[model samples]
Target: MSPDLRVIVYPPDAQGGRRVRVDGEILGRALGPNDLFEFLRQAAQDADDVCLDDGLLIEWRGGGPALGSPDAA
Candidate 1:
């Protein structure tokens, strides 16, 4: 990913789905890594080049890659 590229994974909603944004444009909701990968793949066509664990490339809010409601029992 380019140094100028910015990907933000917003906090999960009540259903445990997160909104994905690339460079400020909202792509869609992702329920897991595959969902997020597809979004990035379509947006940049270089999903293989991205690393979910790379903090500099992706900004994960509320939680990391784990999928679940923060308040879920």
Candidate 2:
């Protein structure tokens, strides 16, 4: 993982949306949960793990998206 690259997602707002932060910078309004993956992909980010607001962990391995770590419960 690149030290300059980190994703931070804030808890849901009144409309059940989240604000995504890439390296401590925000784009505009909050984004839907489904858009997270698309954002990362468009940004060319190849992450081993994606940490959500509720602590749900999504991982990318071998260029595919998975819900969680393969070694965890």
Largest TM-score belongs to which candidate? 1
- Superposed on all Cα atoms, model 1 deviates from the true structure by an RMSD in Å of 4.0
Can you tell me which runs of candidate 1 are displaced by over 4 Å?
Answer: 69-73
lDDT of 2 by residue, 1-73 (tens): 3445666655555554555566656643334434675566555665344443323332222222222223222
lDDT of 1 by residue, 21-48 (tens): 9988999988888888899887865877
Q: Which candidate is the best by lDDT?
A: 1
**Native-referenced Cα lDDT, model 1:** 0.82
In candidate 1 the C-alpha lDDT for residue 48 amounts to 76
The TM-score obtained by model 2 is 0.50
Cα displacement (angstroms), candidate 2, residue 10, comes to: 0.2
Span of 10 residues, lowest total lDDT, candidate 1? 64-73
